[model samples]
Target: MTDPDPFRVIFVCTGNICRSPMAEVVLRALAVQRGLASRVLSRSAGTGDWHLGERADERTLDCLTRRGYDGSAHRARQFSAASFAENDLIVALDRTHERILKAWARSDDDKGKVTLLRAFDPHASSMDVPDPYYAGPPMFDSVLAMIETATRGLFSQLEPAVRAPRTTLRALRRPDQEDLP
Candidate 1:
């Protein structure tokens, strides 16, 4: 069986530079602050390779830094089958990434590993986190808010496994399931 502690999580989006990396850094910081750093591993990637080696967008970096989050060192990477094999959970930023990831699933279990990031948010206004790639700085800020909110909710759902490693992996619900933590 897979190790229950250090539950792995990868945030995925179309470009990796904006939404996914932001989620990754925020989740990592949140996990560290909440004392779940060692029990959770947060990371990110893009569905496409267009910006494979780029740093996050300048606006994203500015917003993170302004919020005192460390996202400066994030280097973009493309999501692959290996990413799925490595992480316990793969979180898609929006419906497009979700559909692409679902198409790339190698097994039922792998497909189950993939879920929408906002699915964890009890108060998410929409099923997808809107892409802020083309928007102004304000949009990035707004999306950052969404990312933080959803990360809190996601960690809440996963906290049981951190506290009691015996918590079954099956407790993590699919995006379609609405069970609250």
Candidate 2:
């Protein structure tokens, strides 16, 4: 577990308005379905800030709404060095996002906390969730399907760790200090 708790997670992508926000809503919905909603706090941001303060892409909203997931309130934002401390897990939607996030990690432990979203998928074909912005409506649908499958797997992976009991808070071990455990 990391400070502020083990269940906080952030989804990452190239831009917040597309894949990452979609992922956030999908995972949040899954958390609710799995009875982990109150225990798991899900969020999202992007590697770039170009769309900051903007709503999620309309295509994404349509796909989520039509699929019974709520994504109406998302606003774009950029992932930053500060995010490393705020989230226990940083889930990158693609390999590129993972690399960008790793560059912000202050220590090896922070780097370790960052993982590709599809890594949770037991039978994933590709690790990257393709950006749907440039493509047509069908691509947005494809993104939704991919996010849904990955988030389900992610929820299962984290659920046990989240449900486990915890001791009193202790400051997270620094990179060098982790070897002592």
The top-ranked prediction according to TM-score is 1
Q: Which residue ranges in model 2 land beyond 4 Å of their true spot? A: 1-6, 168-181
Compute the lDDT for candidate 2.
0.82
All candidates' lDDT scores?
0.88, 0.82
Q: List TM-scores for all candidates, in order.
A: 0.91, 0.87
After best superposition, candidate 1 residue 107: deviation in angstroms? Answer: 0.6
Candidate 1 — which pairs collide? none
lDDT of 1 by residue, 55-146 (tens): 99999999999989978899999999898789888999999999999999999989988888898887888979999999999999999999
Q: Model 1 compared with the native: what TM-score?
A: 0.91
Tens-place lDDT per residue, model 2, 85-119, is 88888999999988888888899989988888887
